[model samples]
Target: MIRIRLGARGLGGVRFAVSPVGAAKDLLRLVGFSPGTLTPQWRTRATDALSRHRLGLLAVVGGGGPLGYAPDFIRPEPPAFLTDINTGLHQIATTPQERIRYELAGAVNGHAWDPGSGHPPPRQLLRALDRGEDHFAHRLADEMARFWHAALAPSWPVIRARLEADVTARASEIARSGLAEALNRLAPNLEWRDGELLVHMRTDSIHQLTLDADAVILTPSVFVDWALFCAGEPPGAPAPRTPLIVYPAAQADCLPPAQDHPLIGAMRRKLLAELSQPRSTTELAQRLYLSPATASYHLQILHRAGLVTRTRRSRHVLYQRLGGAT
Candidate 1:
């Protein structure tokens, strides 16, 4: 468990910012990392984007691999100003020499990644790190930019609107109930006590820090399925940033048009696109050249995500896409 002792300055400066890159990176994790591993709801959503867009560079770099202990440089400190994906990319491209060396070195199994680690950074990524090449950073940023254009751009308006709405709602909650109550709602793993925010992590390790920064950024996430995340760079680690906590916003998979939500699978989106008229699962399956069971499974997922509604008409269970699962 980790505890953040909020100093008066920190307490007063609690603010909300939206992270385009953080959401984008974690979305890659949800879908492209491993199949049938975790967060099926969110994973299925992201699979749609990945299936439609070939993130060649990101895939080669193992950007979405099981690297829970990946370098903190990838997760830059949240800028005080709510940032766009380009801003996030600039920060990554301009990572300081010291931080690049420190965090990348820490990723080897013997370092912080040990005890629990994901797949090692791919050989190519490691080679770039070893050579201390700046091109590696630019390449990474370019890849992320490509990914943003390919996968995130089309749905960014919906995603950004949802994030803004979440922030507005949270601000209202803070106004109505108070900061302590608002903090408690971030995630079940968190609580407010004795001027400190207590985080009950699955890991047994305990950490406590006195928060004396400009602000503690409270960001809302759509890609993070279940857990709350707190990310901060250690002191003297490159450009310092405000500490950040990411929590799930309401209806995390609320994007509708089923065809429009990038978090869904490509196959499902195809099925949904065909659902301008009510159709049976078997009908959808045939239209998409898929098995009935496959169609039914996708339909069920769409139903659960509030993207489609089903009805029974005598013999067939007909499903149609919802206008907007907002």
Candidate 2:
């Protein structure tokens, strides 16, 4: 269990940010062995891509081994909402070597893998860290950039829209209710009371964090499942300057089980299949060989049934499937 004691000013200091790098890191976690925790639909989508690019990404981020720790450098906290992949790559490239080394050492030491029992860190990676080679960091960053472009870039638009929607919904919750109410709703294991935020972690140990004057950055993540993760300075270190709390985004409810129900027609089934990612009406019309008006009509029906959601992006309005619709 982790308990965070917030000062009187903590409530006013809360802020929110969206990080592309963080999302990419979460994707790494999703592709790991524990992906079974993910929705079956999303797991299938991610695994299909992983099979195609397994060899290329394997060298950098090893297989789903017991000592599975992607270098901590890849998970840098963004100072602001990351607008593009290039900006996030730049952040990874420019991270101070000292910080990178510190985080890497911590990951290695804190890992619970039995020595020589499971896949170990890549030989090249171990050598690079031992010899303090800067090239290794650059190579890791390059590989991450390549993986992002090939595997995740295609789905980024939909992912970003979902993240943005979550932020807007959270802000509305804060306005309608209050900060405490919003915080409690973030996850089942979180509670705000007595000027402290309590998080029930899987572990039995109790850890307390004090946020005296620093604001906690609440980041909504699509790939984070189960428990909330707190990122801040290591225990007993210097007072934390910037702290982040990441919680899972609310997923759409599971698709209704009556697939062959009379209410669901052929067009609605096609729309649901294509909605794995968000699409504008024009895009849907072009792909489905239907007129824009027809596509819009079906979309409205799907929206009413709570099977999909719509959001306006600039001049275009996009719709995406909710939950794990088959």
Question: Which digits, one per residue and each the tens of the lDDT, describe model 1 over residues 57-142?
Answer: 45444343343444555556667547878788998888877766765665554433343555555676666666564666776677
Q: What are the clashing pairs of model 1?
A: 45-263, 45-264, 46-263, 48-265, 48-266
- The C-alpha RMSD in Å for every predicted model, in order, reads 9.7, 6.4
How accurate locally, in lDDT, is each candidate? 0.66, 0.65
Residues 246-297 of candidate 2: C-alpha lDDT, one tens digit per residue: 7777773211133432346998889888999999999999999999999999
Give residue 190's lDDT in candidate 1 (0 to 100): 73
Model 2 backbone overlap count = 0
Measured against the true structure, the TM-scores of the candidates, in listed sequence, are 0.68, 0.70
